[model samples]
Every structure is written in C-alpha cells, then in structure tokens.
Target: MNQESRRALIRKLVASRGECSVEQLAVELGVSGMTVRRDLQALCEDGRLIRTHGGATLGERATFEFAFLDRVNKNQEAKTAIARAAVRLASDARSVMLDGSTTTLAVARQLRGRSGLTVITTSLPAAAQLQHEPGIDVLLPGGYIRSASPDLTGSLAETNLELLRAEIAFLGADAVDDRGNVFTNPPDNSAVLLKMAASAQRVYVVADHTKLGKPALRRFGQLTQWAGLITDEACDPDFVDQLQQLGIGVIVAPFE
Candidate 1:
C-alpha cells in the first residue's frame, strides 16, 4: 500500500478497534514492521494517532492500554486453569466484581452455573455472558465503555460502584511485579481499577503469568493491599514465594 493508503487504513483500524498494533497493520497492509512503525510515526506526527509499546491508538480518545485480542486468545489453557481456581475462592450468597481483563472473563465463564450470586461488573462481555444464568443475578454498572478493552470507566461507573460493595473483587492487572505492584497503562484506566479495588472486601487480582513482570505507565497500588494473586501453573514457585512474603495470598492454578 502507498503512504496515504496506509494512513487511511490506520485511521480506520483505530476507529474500529480503538487500537492497532504494528504487527496487525503490517499483516493487513502487506508491509514490514519497520514500514508500519514508520506509518504509525507519520500518523502520530499528523496528530491522528498515539503510539504505544505494541500499537497506536486514535488520538484524543482515552486509550486503555491493551494487547491485541489475539494475544489473549493464545492463552486459553492457562486461563481455564486459572478460572477454575478463582471459582474455588467464591463463597455462598456473595457479591463479586469482575474487571475487563480476559482472565477475569475466564472467571465469569466458570461462575455460570453457581447457584445464587450477585455479580456486579463493568465488563459488557462478562455481563452478557452471565445475564441469562438461572439462579445468578448479573448487574452492570453505568460508565463510558472503553472500546479497546470493552471496560466501563469514568464517573458513571464510579457512581454505580460507590453504591455497592462486594465480598470479593476479581481484578485484572496489565502488569504486576515480584514486589506486588499493580500497574495499568493509562492513568484514567488506573482510576477505574482503583475504584473497583476499593469497593471489595477481598481484592483478588486474576492474572496469567504473562502479566507478572511487564511494566506499564500508571501505578495503582502496593502488594500488601491485595488479598490474593490467582494465576496459572506458569507462575514460578520462587516468585510466588516473593509475593507471599509480602503478605499477599497466592493461588497457583493446578497443572494442566
């Protein structure tokens, strides 16, 4: 594709997907990663897009840091194991909050047949998945849906969250360290996570092993604040020990 064509395609992708990765663009446009990076740079120069670690986003919109959905799709087996463990943590007649991360969505998938529970969340996909369950009540919070992540945020979501409290909140983090630091990419999205974090009795971060060491721009909280860390078997025993040392419970999913 030509320069103008690549630019148009990038804008179209940003509008449709809310973010587009260099790899994705290259595949779509039949170009190299370097060419796509140059294309993204030009778009950034024109003030039409904002570039990130893996991709570029539409300018002027709130871009919640996210990886390509395909990346999430790549870890199905691990997520299934993690989800099974997360469901084990749930108790009876409880209120729970699930965030937008795919890991949290896995938890939502597992909670499907559970008898009586109120699941309050900002994830549209999670809400859709749970709304039809016979004995469970699914509640959605009001908010601006961030398209890339499909998560609710802003004052509207916060207002709904403020009115309710949860026994357990299954949270998702873009990044966590051995030190137990929670991080999000954009500061605005970080506020949404913080609000969700504060309204729960036990804050459980449900992450796959891939998220443990990668860093992001916005820092959310410290290690000790979390009730537990739930991850797949890929979690290194030594690293889990480090988090346990910080007084945060660690639940490693059973080996597949």
Candidate 2:
C-alpha cells in the first residue's frame, strides 16, 4: 500500500487497540519492522501518535482528530465534488456558518481563496484551515472542546450561536434517512447544529452518497428545514426522487 494509506491503517489500528508495537504492526501490515517504525515516527510528528519504547499510542488529541481525518479521507472525491457545489450556493453570502463535520471541512478548504467573507464555525479544524487565509475572517464560538471530537460543544456554544446571524449555513450529517431526516453520529453536536441552522437565513446539508439511508444516533433536523441538500452524483436517483417528492431540493454535485 501507499505511504498515506498505510499510515491511515496504522492509525486506525492503534486508535482501536490503544497501542501497538512496531513488530506487531509490521507483522499485521506485511511490512518490515523498520518501515513500521518509520511510519510510527511520522505519525508522532503529526501529533496523531505518541511513540513508546517499541510501540506507539494514540496521542491525547488524536482520538477525535484521527477519527475525523479518517472520515475526511474516505470518499474524498465525493466530498470534494459536494464542496464545489456547496461553494456555488454561497457565492452571494457574506457571512457563513459551517458545522464541525469532515464534509463541511471540505467546504472550508474550498473557501480559503475567497475574500471578504465572515465564517462562523463550531469546528476547530475548520477554523484552523481558514485562519491563515488573509481574505477570510474566521470566528469560533466559546465552548468547551468535545473530548471525542475536535469541535466546540456545550450550552455556551449554543448560546453564542444564537447571538450570531449568517446568510447561509452548511452542515454535514452522519446519515440522511429516506424520509428526509438528517442525523448525527454521536448526537452531542445536534443542539449546536440546530442553533446554527436557526441562526442562518439559509442552510444546506452537505453529504455524500454513502450517507443515504444510513441510520445514526440522533436526528438533528428535517431536510425540509434546510434550503436544500448538496450531495455527490453517486447518490441513488430513486432516493433523490423520493426526497424531492417530499418537497426537499437535492443538488447532485457532478464529479470534476
């Protein structure tokens, strides 16, 4: 496997197992111990792993961030397509709200080049991604960082979201059911997302085809509540039709 893919697998293994020896990883991955050590060193430098004497453990911040990155790398092409389409919808928006999802992080990456835009986000990674852009103003609400994810949560964050207004909000869901319901995986951030949706004049749920018909932990909102849904073209057409039958607008982002 390629270096990136190998490293991703190593991360997943370590995250799940809590720790792994270089010898164990090499045996499991069918690679040399030297190679596993090298990979582990790289992961340590990236703050995703902490190297032990002959093994590695997940870093303090790696639990959520590693999982987040893993999700971001999955179905990346679809997420990129969705981000392109989602950006077009924000062409006239001066202020935007972005939720702390990997898909929405893709949208933030697309917005990096744009200037004179105010971005309010609950995502630490999203804010970090755009913070270096001279043209975009990134704002993060005050809340305790989630232990399981790299985002803000709590009543403080929800109250802060209520005080702000945005022209448009782009959110990501863990699942989008057949009945036009949107769901989040862990349910901790549902209230924060609901507040974001409420504070925006328009909201769009950006997801990929894999999320269609999937079941998640909690229902955040209905597809009808958002202005529309932006998803990759690989989504089933019949499902799209079903959603449209319910008066939900779905935008299929074609692959570039």
Name the best candidate (by lDDT).
2
What does candidate 1's lDDT look like per residue over 19-74, in tens digits?
88889888988999998898888878877788898898777632332243454576
* Candidate 2 global CA lDDT score: 0.92
| Least well predicted 10-residue stretch by lDDT in candidate 2 | 60-69
TM-score, each model? 0.72, 0.82
- How many clashes would you count in candidate 2? 0
Candidate 2 per-residue lDDT over residues 57-135, each given as its tens digit: 9888778676767888999999999999998999988999999899999999999899899999999989999999998
Candidate 1: lDDT over CA atoms?
0.80
Please list the C-alpha lDDT of all candidates, in the order they appear.
0.80, 0.92
The reply for model 2, stretches above 4 Å from the true place, is 1-51
